[model samples]
Target: MTARSSSAHVAEVEGVRVDTRHWIGGRRVASDATFTDVSPIDEQSIADVHAGGQAEVDAAVTAAREAFGTWAAMPVKQRADILRAVADGVDARRDDLAMVETRDNGSLLRSHLRGVMPRVAMNFRYFADLAEQISHPIDEIRGHRQRVSYDPAGVVAVITPWNAPLMLATWRIGPALAAGNTVVLKPPEWAPLTASLLADIANDAGLPAGVFNVVQGSGARAGAPLTRHPGINRLSFTGSVPTAGVIAEAAAKNIVPLSFELGGKSALLVLDDADLDLAVTLAVEQFDNAGQVCLGAFRVLVHESLHDEFLQRVLASASALVQGDPRDEATDVSALVSRPHFERVRGFVERALADGARAVLGGGPNDDLGGLYFRPTILVDARPGSEILTEEVFGPVLTVQTFATEEEGIALANDTRFGLAATLVTGDPERAERVSARLNAGTVWVNCFFVRDLGAPFGGNGKSGIGREGGAWSFDFYCDVKNTVFAPHGWHAVEGGGDS
Candidate 1:
């Protein structure tokens, strides 16, 4: 066990690195079966977890359903209070959780995404404020008083991806709790330990028994049953297109309300008028989180005039990223979440190479890395249907292509079946605005890339996802809308109030 900084509020961190179980009905319980936690560094078992299944999912669902009445009936302020407590607890134990996240997820080269905590903390707090600000409608019918109010949606099932365990959880957890709903969380099996630890944080924060429950298991056995559970009122899912497609199908059986944050093959347009140096920096940074980020600018479209220079600058920037142990503060790029992810990304590169996509810079895995470390690859001249151009290579890989005009750049950027996010670097404000409007992605950054302020509404457009995940609009995703009109104590008005 390693000691943490003052914020963690603990003397030492537990390094036993054992597998995690589940949190059902407010307690840690083990499933009948278990699964191994494979280390990205050596492809060996570092830890294991209760091999969760339909039973565990059923238990979590039962717990949530049992508490849904009281939880949904609780005042919004009280629910907000519980959320605030969770945020405070997360902050209190930030460093320990960060370490565990790094250990479990094989953060590229392995960096605990704890850097995202400050924003996550803000997410919980912002949702708390938004809770108090939930709009209630007041209407006057025939000059008389009438009112409408919001209501809860019972149990919410939040299924988050391994790429960002805590941050994505916070996004859903904060709003669902604030909106007066009980939650059953199913973290990705790839990063179950950290998610279970987060459940512990909620328990310590004094969330009521069964108000928040966590289940650990695979999507097929656990996630499928959970989403299809009749008890679950809404499902907030973040993951891949194929998985999302499956979850959506199961959810449709019950006609459950769904909030999906899926994949993105986004683009970054480097305009000829942009600052070349800044453009280079933004390109690599935009693709931070090893391009695993759904919002990352994976595809780069540079104006033809600046293509050569921009390519050179971006290559140097990508080359400079220090990839190694995520725990090492000096490291910028870490290993992907697992060896499978490494292979998945490498396969994309290999397919590109097989095609005419030229290996402009890096192109494959770094054999020197004992762990799963891949060199930042850059491919140029990829054709329309190339793997590097169409699919998400969620690794330290970049693909570069040239566009003759701003229109062409925009066209190429939006040409994909995906529309998650895009960034434009241009000195001309008018040009940036014009391009931003034309790009089909949900988020468009001008002169900046992948930087977030926490308050912004974050989600995708088109295939990326449905509905927003942040800002005031977040309440709508978690809380169901009900219009209730109560008129004054008189039955004078008829259906046709015009009085023919």
Candidate 2:
């Protein structure tokens, strides 16, 4: 229940000791086995978390299943009020939560406090208001009066990734709760601190026991069981594609619906008519979280006319970014989540160089700052078909490629298997509209990058993901739609009663 200030360099959170346990039903629960949580910033032990396996998953799912009816049956106004309180609770403890997340995931404290923390509360508020405004519409068809209603999808297994842990978790949890489904969240072991804190906040907000639960551990030990559990009616996962496939297979066994927000090798197309300054600004912004974001512009497809100019601008921006301790407010790029991930990202750059791609700026790790730090790299002259251009390198690396014509640019943008998100920078509104339609991505940004509206749908197409997760789309995903038909009493079927 405690965290260090943003200025502290050590991983120690004051009151949170070793043996941090799971939050099941309404209270803390422990397991025999435990795993150590190491800080990405310093590679120091943060805490020893109870490693919840199938036994813990069973307890959490059972609790959620038991609580579903009561939570679903609660008055809409009451649910809205509870959600509002949860939002307020997050706002009240914003600094602490942000510090915990910074320690857990090595994200910049400035970004966490200024960008992420506010969105955490905003997400809850959005769903809270939506709960009150939601309505069931009626329709008349073929002489039958039909009313369509939405019901909770029962117990939902919310599995979140390490990067942007709480924000992404809330993306599913908020809508799922607002839709009246009980949630058993399984946060990534690497970054479970903030999520655990969130559960505590929800409890303080008077969220009933068993209505929300949190199980902490790795994917195989905790996530697999949660996904395979037959008691779970739906699964919402935001992580890598391979892990998502495993979850999808397990959910399929139980015929449970799933919403997968998987990885992305998204493209940012800089058209010939683009504003060079704005394009470069957006490109740097895409790499804000050290390029750990799912919607990051991994592949930069610039029109041949502006390719050289764009590369020059981007290189300057990437090189000027400060890389140091995440605790420091001035640090622009922090460490990767772990040493393994650091090596993986380093390997991507090395392999690209070995395969004949040239480095425009940084080419490898930054041992100067210590910890799992990688210099923000820009790989140029990368072939379109190469792994560097096609795969999801979740790091501060940008691959630049050129296209001759508009047709070629669009084609190159959609060349990859991932269709999560794409950005187009152009001055012409007509060209923006025309190219956006052909991009083949779930969300397309025009003239800007990462511009999001909570009311709009947010998800991917193709291998990027399966379903949407925002606004009405999120509510629909977490709820089951049922059609009720009403028949008139003593109604004889008159000839042509319904004007077919």
Candidate 3:
């Protein structure tokens, strides 16, 4: 894929060259405070992003509110057609968007171009088709017919994370729009470029002004305001648990319904009868995207009978992974999003080692790369209660534990505060089914990992999240259901008149 020329689209604000800006009310807008975008690969300046705050958040929410009525009034087919056009627009700009995201978030260009971008467009199309099939269901009772219809939830605030900016943002935006809701999206400050580009694409696809808006800045400044804004009818946030708590409190003030997809320390279980090679492959591959994925298998629980063998294979596979610049197509792992994140991940490994956990593979930073690079680390003999095993590292570090019985494995996997996702690898289909039924996670993959169906519900339980997302779940979250009861024209109401 060819990289788009970024210089040609540079914007000038007050005689200063700016590469990023906010999209509010269908146009690019600048902000008084600016944040520099630095590439994680080399720590070089990539652009100056607009640092939007309360004022900008207010403007965005106001715009979405103003456009909600008109957007919600649009016919379903027309809305579907517009969503298809948006999907087409994203497909056309796939390469450019992939490059922007890779530069902004340190994702491998190959994966972004092949996996993330296509999935982004697919999400819009999926919701579009679902929207076309929606209908109001009616139930008839004694002298009345109740028609249950869905309506847009008015203005929605979508706060997305940096890990997979565009993909996750569209996960909220597509369904919200398809359900006739106007949206104000706040992309994490660490990766905001593609979100602005998405705003441009929506405008080109004929999305009405104020129907969709993008605000770029820190979570405390932009995201907090969006959550608290009274104009917003619903909130959908994907981030850490602490942040979700803060948002939950703010949304409660106005009784705004919310969908929270919070943090996870998901486990990948390798049963005694499982195919060891496939299990190792799946475990090591969890480090894809530098383990920033929320569903990543950070904790691996292997049957004691297979633990030693699995550990050797895991160590070898992880050691063979190539870590270099993200732009390098062959690179398996890229730098963390920033230096602070890198230090945090390194600290996890350092503390784990100091606590008597053995580093079976990588345990240090790659200083030679001159960037925020942490080696793909694997830890064994980590105490089950240790921070590395219990908390979310959110980096390319996998902690291994051993379980003697199938019951113990299941218990170990479900011991975390998060129940976002889990994986079970086993040759016995009966065991897979039985153990999957016992797992507390929202999604349990049997003999595989990251296998998703766009039509199925996706979310978490426990501290991981509040409600489901994806397909019909998205529609439900962004919409309000109203029941309209119509009584027979000449009917008279009487207490206890109806006969069973």
Clash number for each model:
9, 0, 0
Tens-place lDDT digits, model 3, residues 359-436: 887888876775698888888899768899888999999989999999899999999989999999999989888999
Better of 1 and 2 by lDDT: 2
Alpha-carbon runs more than 4 Å astray in model 2: 1-19, 489-500
Q: What TM-score, over all chains together, does every model reach?
A: 0.93, 0.95, 0.95
- Across 1-500, the per-residue lDDT of candidate 1 in tens digits comes to 23233421122223533226688898878767776666554555655567677888889899988988888888878878888888898788776677766766756322444466666677788888888986787877665555656577889999999887877887888888888888999888887766776777788888888988888788887888898898899999999888888888988999998988887988888888989998888888854666677788878888899988888777777778877766777887777888778889888888888887888777877777856777777888888777788887777777888889888888999988888889888999888878899999878888887667556777888889987777666777777776655556785664446622
Residue range 67-120, candidate 2, lDDT tens digits: 999999999889989999999999999888888888889898888888898999
Q: Assess each prediction's global lDDT (C-alpha) against the native.
A: 0.78, 0.87, 0.87
Model 1 is weakest, by summed lDDT over 10 consecutive residues, at 4-13
Off by over 4 Å in 3: 1-19, 492-500
